[model samples]
Target: MLHPRITRVALGASVCVALAACGGGGGGSSTAVGGNSPPATSNAQITGKAIDGYLSGATVCFDNGQGACDLSQPTTTTDANGNYTLKVSGDATGKQIDVLVTPTTVDRSNPSGAPFTTTFTLSAIVSGATQNVTPLTTMVVAQMNAGKSQDQATQAVQNLVGSSVDPGADYIANGDSNTTGVAADMVGHLEALYGNGPVSWTLVQATMNAYAAVGNVEGVQQSDVNTQLSNMALSQPIAATAALADSLYAVDGDLIQESSTGAVVSPGLSPVRENWTLSGSTLSITQEVQSSGAWSAASPVGSYDGWFSGNFIQNTAGLGAMLMKTDGTWTNWFPNSQLHPAYALSSVGNNLVGTDPNTGDAITASYRTIDVSGQPLSTALQIDYRNPVRGSMSGTFPTGTTAYLASTQHANDQLMLTESGIGTAQSGSWSASYSPGTGVYWSSLSDPTQTLTSVQQVVGTQIQVDGPCLLLHIEAGGVAQIVESGASGCNYANEPISFPVAGSWSVYPRNPNVITISLPKSVGGATVPITDTIKNTINAGGSLVVALVNGVLLSGYMLPASSVSTVQQFPATVTDTIAAAMRAAATNIGETQNP
Candidate 1:
């Protein structure tokens, strides 16, 4: 939740299970949509399961929101096992089916075993093959209702929430709690919000409706709702995963050694072996107790059995969606921060499939291996999480650290020729570096070879190999101190997993225009250091933004530094700082909006 104004409500307070038992469970056949009177195949039925923690005693029906699901339609109540076989016919074959799970359902998944009131979920069937209604599918339905094609809607929701379980299959029945666990959290939160009586019916309905509208109910952002659910994933204790997230976990047998910030001191040791003491947070640190296979699971809260993205694993489900390749290794990391909720994922057919964030076409991570025989071999990381970008990542931020620079936009130039007369007066230190025929040339101080040599046109900031993850915006003629700071718009496709904040980040001082991030990539057995430098002011908000630029990195260190050469100075007088802050807040027109 952006602002966690949570009000914990009591569950199962009354023995009363007066759910929406009022809704009839008798709709019995298939109905065609767009009006095609095709012959019906009476024996043709759709099979699936409904599990908000194995929701039994609930009614499932088929409807297009246009006609009533009476005896002519297919409907059935969930079995004691939460399974349902909606009676269908050939007419339902080509048509899109909105499998509706009415709120009159009760959740046995939560310890409370309460019933949902006034809350119903809808999942759109793209093909008869996908005939299930999970929370992820519910979001897909909302997106579809908002006008996206079912495929588009499904990808959109997957991108946002992360992970792709066969929404059509029952995770519970399949014995996959990694996914079912996430589903339970999703269901549990909705149930908690729905509460147990007539008074909460409207609240529950409004949350679903508002969520469908891509709006918030009860001060919750849709992302917040996702976070609330995922945060619940890490709300429990998983010390091993917890160490990977930010601190160190020294289990009796396993030894993971690291400082407070999530830098992995151990390469690949099951059950970390460190006598760790977290520097800043109150996270539970345990010593290693090494044992081989057959280990029991920690709380799913922040536990992720994947590769590291940053110094921490920002979003477990988000990474789960990547379907990244893993080495049969598994662990979880809990970011002490609440904004970045915890999640987990498992392989789905090993086919890493997802909608391209920009084009919406089926695409896999570009960083994954290419073909040797004109096609990627199964061993080369195809669908089902084979992308290198889909691996687990650790982060390097202090515990209890709240804010970092966020970029809704930025101008990470491929080449620069004195942006907005940045080289106008004195031209500072970089001006002395190199002067070309047309524009000035400055090579990154970190690497003398990679020169900023090109026209000043803004590089597209949309997930290109070397670009800031957030939207990119830069002022045209003037310089500003802080870039927009707060993490919201790192389009869902930033798992390293190409997702945002999932990017490595660290806030050294209060809010400096310069946000230094340590994104460690092991190449040829050594770590590659990539750096990004914004101008001279910290983001207005204390929020951290994960700025990512692919290799041969630029320490834009002193480049943007010149922008503040004449404007902002450290140990700045309080009056000067306030003046600069006011200037930073001032609205400027025509700033570079390099999308």
Candidate 2:
């Protein structure tokens, strides 16, 4: 079991408060009035400026650390030039005290938006002496940049001043003019106070380290001078690996699957599902076969067991491996030990990219972990692309019109074909079996027919035909249900014209043996249904039938299951004879329509 790693990057700015202060104000020499007794009174004048200039009307309060500020005269406001003076008597006199200045409003022009108060300690003084308080503007701006937020930065400044680490007021005051120098100077001040004590890096180093840890060097670089400072302490490999591991664990499971579609491997091939297994440093992968719809278990199609070195996972055998960077991008040539071809990959959040080793084509995919309850059950699979053998035919109908047909067959004994150029588009379906040794083929076509009376009464349309047509219904479970009816063709001026018939079929679960098919005939945007019933045939096998009525016929044969897998192993081919026949019939229809 892998345990999550805790990185030092988790430490926040507030935690730095435990370190010493970074501001000024030290105790002075004391004079004994009566044998080491402190002075009874001390006088000090405090003055400061806002970011723009003088901070007038700002409140300055004195706390002796005992919460004893004269409330009646507890605070004094700065004048127009940001100058303020306070007279200290009582317990505050001759004792080190904290002076807090709360600005009435911050300088809106300052980018940092630091609107909090500034605090500084007043050195113990005798009567008639003055202590210059650092300007609030410089203190606030430096704190804001260090902590990256107004509130946190203000607190940091207070902590610095309270600890007596003097951040040079003059340098801070001119910070906007020479930001680089001022920032460096402020960092030096913080380092002097907290550097050797508990917090090691200066504020500058800590901020840069944080950004660099997350592959955000661009952010640090934008700060200009901090770029050089950050590079000294930047360590992303260790942190990035921990982060990547955490992300991988969140979506890890016993098995994962991804559905993909592209021409990277084969043209017009059906979609495939790729399975993956990730265990510690090892990874295994396999693909589900299209025909069987089952995963191969003998061995993984590929496997790679590696260890993370730097920002990458290199194979222990040193044949090939993958390179992963802190920015969530990767490139690899794993499992293909030859490493003749290379591929690039990126993993951002949930996206994945790669390339095929053999073809050198781009491969894109996405994945999700599968939740398994127990041994998975297998069910009947749907028909899919295997060997598509195309076929076509052309012929003249009794109604004195030409017809054309085109068809293709897939695995699982399924067939689909289309016949166009008739009054309406026509389609055909079949199940088939073929033998290359004897050049013998057997196929079945379903032809369902509608009664002429039902067509006129129920469908509310008139059709011309000499006699009844054989109606074949292909039902669920491969059952062929026949409805004895008449031929279908359009009537024009009492003359028969060949036309295509269209219909839909449905079966009820309660009585699956019975199938009901409906054909709608449209008249002036309104439709009438021609419905019929047929019984399902049971396992009708190995025989071709062509039932003719009024010079129209439907032909084909039932297919066996054993040949399905064999068909999938071969490439698709079209029957030249069948294709020629369909082309000739289409040509006839074109001649008639165009003429």
The best candidate by TM-score is: 1
> Once model 2 is optimally superposed onto the true structure by TM-score, how far is the C-alpha of residue 132 displaced, in angstroms?
5.1
Q: Give the least accurate 10-residue stretch of model 2, judged by summed lDDT.
A: 531-540
Give the CA lDDT, 0 to 100, for residue 187 in model 2. 26
Estimate every model's Cα lDDT from 0 to 1. 0.29, 0.24
TM-score of each: 0.32, 0.20
- Write one digit per residue (lDDT tens) for candidate 1, span 1-595: 1011111121111111112221111122312111112234244676665655556776666643421233456678878766777766554543434333444555555454433432344333334533555655554443443345656654554443345655445555677655554444344444333332221111222233333332212222222222211111112222222222333221111122332233443443333122222233222222222233223333222232222211112212111211111221111211222212211212112222233221122321101110112111111111111111111111121222211100111111111111111111111223224322223233222122334332121221111112232322222332112122234453333222222322233332322222333221111000111111121111111112221122211222111211100000011122222222222222132111111
- Give me the displacement of residue 475 in model 1, in angstroms: 26
lDDT (Cα, tens digit) per residue for candidate 2, span 320-418: 322222221223223323322233443322323444443333333232121111100100001110101101122211121111010111122211111
Question: For candidate 1, what is the lDDT?
Answer: 0.29
Model 1 has a clash total of 77
Poorest stretch of ten by lDDT in candidate 1: 562-571
- Model 2 misplaced regions, further than 4 Å: 1-41, 44-53, 63-73, 90-176, 179-595
